[model samples]
Target: MRRLIAVALAVVLLVAGCTRNSDGAADVQVGGDPGASPTLRFRAPLTVTEPSSTVVWAGTGSALVEGKPVLIDYWLENAETGAVVAESYTTSPKPYLLTKESLGTDLFAALRGQRVGARIVEVSPASAARGMTFPTVIVMDVLATRAEGDPVPARPGMPIVTLAADGAPTITPTTTTPPTDLTVVPLIKGTGDQVPTGAEVTIQYTEVDWATGAVVDSTWSTGLPVSFSLAGLGAWSQGLVEQTVGSQVMVVVPPSFGLGGPAGSELQSATLVFVVDILAATKPTAPVSPPVTIAPSTAPSSSPTS
Candidate 1:
């Protein structure tokens, strides 16, 4: 996972014979189709005296908002040698919480006002504290973090779900009796890869109680998605195994399907409803242990147990 860039003060020294545009961006050429690896053309030994960012292409999608999750594909290269350092285009796009605390000042500024599908280039000077002797350039493509897919009509008896302007979901349970079996319904059908069992899944979810129609927990409140192995979350493991990325799903879990807690617990007999947005799913490279279970309280454990 990509982490926040470390910030440290360094003396800014101008490099001789380097050209910069009006925006302070390096005079480099960027060419590529959207959603593909960008081609960069620049003189070797390129250097920048200060950090600069330029949007190579503006997106036609929705504007990026702060305190929300953003997905991005990035390519980092050494501007001095034209050597590729790290990239996400060959792998999967990474997710980040769009906050200054999570993305650091420079990165946050670069992505702050941009919209989804925008491609941005950031140039940074060398910093000894960061172990960089040569300047680096990073190209980033912002992707939609929310579910974007074909809307699917939900089952008649399932709870009603509504979305806020920011894509946070609200669940309203009906007066109808809860189902006795585990039920999975896709509220939105995505075009991405299907999630396999035991895959590490990233999702934004809201959990509601069926009987009281009260919300028990939500990831939107925290402004970050959660990623975990779907091994022991009984209903989640069963229902989400074949779900695709960028999809939104509604799951009805009876107490027998788990997530209500151990026997004799307060919610052990309760029926649970979940509205989940599937962000990303990747198979683990190594064996993963089941996550620890927390003691049940007024709210159930975020990681449901078998």
Candidate 2:
């Protein structure tokens, strides 16, 4: 029999660089707002005395929090040659879920507590570059933090859910019989932005069978949350849409929503339960432009008046 667990985790883009230094003048000068691309000005072949970072400008918006998604635009250049090694300016700003696993300690520390719209300049020695050929100077702009959605009311007669200090949920079912229709209850109300329909969401979840009360699968055991498009999730898609970041939800699905359909397995007719914590959500992709078409011009010739 197939299990009903769906684990989708966000892909972390690891950028290697050096440590951050305070109380020192920047060898590389930088300019730009958090909303636009960055402009780096420095002497090519600039020598780095030590690893350090400087907040060229502080953002006046919301402060950044760890373990959440942050949108950032950055440009990395070789200190010696001033050549561009990497950048996200030409494309969309990248979403980074800040963690030691996803980013280096230095880069993660440098971004901690930074506000949306803040710009920073960082210098790292070759040693900090993880044996790269040249030292690096990276200019970054903090664009925005992921929005947390609004809260929903908890439903009655559902399973009781409690969280551990570390944020793992324990589900205790109330009734023996499974629910006939889809049942969704919001246990915790989040005050952040509302999650848009079909947005890609990062979450940790657990699935269990109502009959046996056995956990089919859980993302917590993997030690990290997963990412998936809400629209892509067939059975597990209802309670997540429009949920807020940092909010926990409980969903009860009938056999039709469970994997394998009704004829596939005995458990396919069994009720499925899920507890989900929405960590973050990504912005939808921009709409593409339609193809251009050319047409012949229609005109009349002019005659000279005598």
Candidate 3:
């Protein structure tokens, strides 16, 4: 994950005017589709007295909410020489929380009220960072960072799932005895690519113990999504392999397929219920590496034997 721009600078709100001298960002010419790298045209040695942002195209998708994750593809260049400084189009878009601290003041202002699919252009004065002696220009494309799909009614006998306003899930375990075998259910069918084994996946999930209905872990509480190799999550790797991006899936894992904890721990022989939102997935071009070990809150120094 790439870090955002320097946070030491002050906030600069979007300037409102029609001429190049009044709003430098409006003077910039942006060309290209929404999701691709944009072609920027402006005179060399451009002078920007203050930071300004101009929306190149307004989006029709959902509005970006505060504290939620925002995905964006950006191209930053030196305005003076019209030289490229950094960009994300060559690789993948980066994710950031929609907060002043996470996106810096200028970026936060530029994307604050925008919706998914919007393209924006921002021009700012020089900063203290290396190679940033001259003013800079950035073009950004907003992308959805949460699951967006057609809701599918879950089959009977599955755990009851409810969603918060921001898309976090709450799983209510059934009163009946838990299933003894692994079960996979797709609660939201996505239109994105199907996940493959060993793919690097980014997800937000809540894991509960079926026997107690207690939420033992949740990515929602942390306020950020996590990405990892799908090689060592036991039933997760098996159940999510064929799932599609932008999907919300529920997986019930028996003790045999669950992440076994230390002896005498509640998770050692417990059934694990997981509600997962698959945000993104990319198949590996090289050999997959083993997943990092995640120690449970009640576990000892040793790693789980699963």
Model 3: per-residue lDDT, tens digit, 1-306?
Answer: 122232111212232223444433335667886555688777677776776677778887789998787877678777789887776554345667888777777678878999988988777777665235677777778876667899998788778999988888988888777888888889998887898887767677888888777987887886666666675555667778989988999988788753646567768888888888887676655322221112111211111234
Model 1 Cα lDDT, one tens digit per residue, 1-306: 223132211211122123456544356667778766788777777756777677777887789888787777677777789888776554345667777766767778878889988987776778786567778877788877678789998688778988898788888888898889988989998777899888777677889899887888887786666666787667778878999888999988888765777778778889998888887676665312221111111212555666
The Cα local distance difference test for each model comes to: 0.71, 0.57, 0.69
**lDDT accuracy of residue 109 in candidate 3:** 82
User: 215 in model 2: Cα distance from truth in Å?
Assistant: 1.6
Per-model TM values vs. the true structure: 0.74, 0.57, 0.74
What's each prediction's clash count? 0, 13, 0
| Candidate 2 Cα outliers beyond 4 Å, as residue runs | 1-47, 53-122, 126-154, 260-266, 286-306
Q: In candidate 1, which residue ranges exceed 4 Å CA deviation?
A: 1-46, 77-97, 128-134, 231-233, 284-301
Candidate 3 stretches greater than 4 Å from native: 1-49, 77-93, 129-135, 231-234, 258-260, 284-306
- lDDT by residue (tens digit), candidate 2, 73-119: 56776778887766645433445566654556666777888887677
Which scores better on TM-score, 1 or 2? 1
User: How much is the lDDT of residue 61 in candidate 3?
Assistant: 75
Which clashing pairs does model 1 show?
none
